[model samples]
Target chain A: MIAADLAPGAVLSLECPTITRTALALYAGASGDHNPVHIDIDACRAVGIDDVFAHGMLSMAYLGRLLTDSFPQQSVRSFEVRFTAITPVNASPTCHATVTDVEDGHAHLDLSVQLPDGTETLRGRAVVSLP
Target chain B: MPVDRSIIGSRTPAFSTVAERGRLRFFAQATGQTDPVYTDVAAAAEAGHPDLPVPPTFLFCLEMDNPARGSFLSDLGIDVRTILHGGQSFRYHAPAYAGETLTFWTEVADVQSKKGGALELIVRDTHVERDGAEIATLTGTIVVRDPRAGR
Candidate 1:
């Protein structure tokens, strides 16, 4: 598995536009988490935000996509992440991942999500088990 | 007096967890996934999948009892709502296709104190199989924290 071959400090980053509405709709539909802060722009702005925000899981799913794509040969055995900040919608968001450690058949990665303004939106880690 | 760390090693019993088809469809629809592999069995085979397959996150819908249910953590004075999603990990030996009954077992691995608050790590694992063939195993972590005390 490529996960077994990754060296510590290996990093991957991607910058992409944020589809806030689509993501919130998707997560709300998928997880049944229909919180207004994700979909209601007016509601979001009521609390001093520019626009609606993406669901934490949507950003997490992007990390999931990263793990599955990076080590296609390996089945992800474990993953963990913390939502540091809100991911704003209708804007661009950059996502990155770095290999932090590999031991006992597990590859650990430090991940982050950022906005164009250089705001750090999320930070977390994911571990994959090698085949 | 400090709590006993011995309870961390307790294991939960394996049991049959229901996978509701309608809910799976709803979840798939919500995610904007339209693949026939997830909605139709025959189409899944036509697409080369063994059976109808749900998305990776589908496992969360199944509410299984903790092996240490009503014990340990809560007994030690932990609040469930203060807990947040730590992360999820899954291993697929084979695709867990739809229409198949799946069984899973879980256990608590460890718990430790973090600088800001107590981070209670509970590992809930599920091993899925069909007709004696192992299909997948998922290990998920739920991090319980005292949100009121954290930074």
Candidate 2:
């Protein structure tokens, strides 16, 4: 695992690797967050959304997965994220995290969820404590 | 039927409890969180927290429908197995620490359905109060997926 030593402003991007509806549903089953906006396309269109979207937690969960899998001192101290927009499933979602600041054995990251067109679906930040 | 927007300001009944240290440790371990402050009370106090603070995600285990934690959506006629976790965002008025009695409530914030899918937004508000003073409010947004559609 790489150390959470990215200089402030360093950025990294990850593409959603076909985290299909089935995978999402399974996560919901395990996590108990069964929301139809993430599953019902019709429901999504009713809200003027282009397509069914992934759960906000699901997005953050992926980021959490990234933190645990890639960064050093994997345990997250305090995580804070905000959703600016919804991520559509029609195209692949690219997730990126930019190192914003580091202090007290923690690194703060500016994160984003975006589409193939580079349209941002969500933006947030997290403070992860290194081991 | 349309979801009532007036309920936004209403607060659900609060449930209170002190998290067992063992359980808190287990939760931190289960979520793969290894921060010493979460695992050690002394470390937490040294960091200025009154006690070991549970991970923010740890609340999901308590509020969300888990067999042991009880079901939050089953009464709504929602099948626990068919749903998908949609989104979660939090506005922290204060940081949550362990051993504090937390009074929590949930309200159905927004419910919108589309041709492709439906999204139910539920907000959970938890207040960590001590002697009537306000501590923190944890607002969570949950989305449950509809099962009848093709992914």
Candidate 3:
């Protein structure tokens, strides 16, 4: 149970919940990240953005699920992400993991959250202990 | 206008928050997490956790528990309207669980201006501790675009 049969070249993926206006609202309140750019259309327009977008943290949270689903939560030693693009509302994001290295009882993996159109919303890395 | 480099090294007072179950479950639901261990302690215990393990990235939510969270930006005359999240990272030295009281404090690690001063980014490192021992560190970048920059 401590290991996930992972190897240096293994690839893992999971489709996350499609982002919607309702999901944005719920996240805004629950995470206390009430950035109006994520929930209010008028607010988005005020900033010249045509439509509200998903919070970057929301995408990062979904990416975390990829790790949890594959390995035990406690096994995750580090997680990181760079916000590269905006995830417009209604976009379905997919989380991906590719093992880059396995050593010293841990697996180092490259991670990403990408949209259906192939836009990578987030990219980064993670280190997880196998034992 | 670029963010003043002097702001680097500014630190926030240490604050504390409890990882309550209700908020954890709410966050889990909001993220569309179907895993029962994140919501049910019994399931978490069955999974060998002492309690509901703090889901990855949830600590960022708890980091917002710093009561003066907004002061850092507000005090700098930065309009919340012009801000965006650039990127962030986390390193966990130990697993955090629900019901544990964790203390958090942040320091401005660096400040930079990019895209010809159209964007200013503030890098912060937040330290999360429990029982006086460090459990996690979160590094985040807050981007503030000059509203007048006109893209």
Candidate with top lDDT is: 3
Q: List the residue pairs that clash in candidate 3.
A: none
TM-score of 1: 0.59
Name the weakest run of 10 consecutive residues (lDDT summed) in model 3 chain B.
B142-151
Q: Write the per-residue lDDT of candidate 1 for residues B1-151, one digit (tens) a residue.
A: 2334675766666556546667667655654455555667687678676665655556544433333444545686754344445555555565555566776556566555555435656555556666667666666565665544432
On residues B1-151, what C-alpha lDDT tens digit does candidate 2 reach at each position? 2234455666556566655577677655433356677779898778777777755554554555323223445545555434544445543445556676665556555555444445555554544444466544445554555544444
| Candidate 3 displacement at residue B71 in angstroms | 1.6
* 1 or 2, greater by DockQ: 1
RMSD of each: 6.6, 7.9, 1.5
TM-score of every candidate relative to the true structure: 0.59, 0.55, 0.96
Give the Cα-based TM-score of candidate 2 against the true structure: 0.55
Q: Rank the candidates by DockQ, best first.
A: 3, 1, 2
Shift of residue B105 alpha carbon in model 3, Å: 0.3
lDDT per residue for candidate 3 within B30-63, as digits (tens), equals: 9989899999999999999999989999999999
Q: Provide DockQ values for all models, in the order shown.
A: 0.21, 0.14, 0.72
Relative to the true structure, candidate 3 has a C-alpha RMSD (angstroms) of 1.5
Lowest lDDT 10-mer window, candidate 1 chain A? A65-74
Local accuracy of candidate 2 as per-residue lDDT tens digits, A1-131? 34545678787766665557765565555445556666777765665545666665656655655554455322454455666565555446777888888778777788787777877766777676666
The fnat scores of all predictions, in order, read 0.23, 0.11, 0.73
**Model 1 segments more than 4 A misplaced:** A1-58, A62-131, B1-4, B34-36, B40-43, B63-77, B116-118, B123-125, B129-134
Q: Between candidates 1 and 3, which one is better according to lDDT?
A: 3
Residue pairs with backbone overlap in model 1: B12-B67, B52-B98
User: How good is the docking of model 3, by CAPRI class?
Assistant: medium
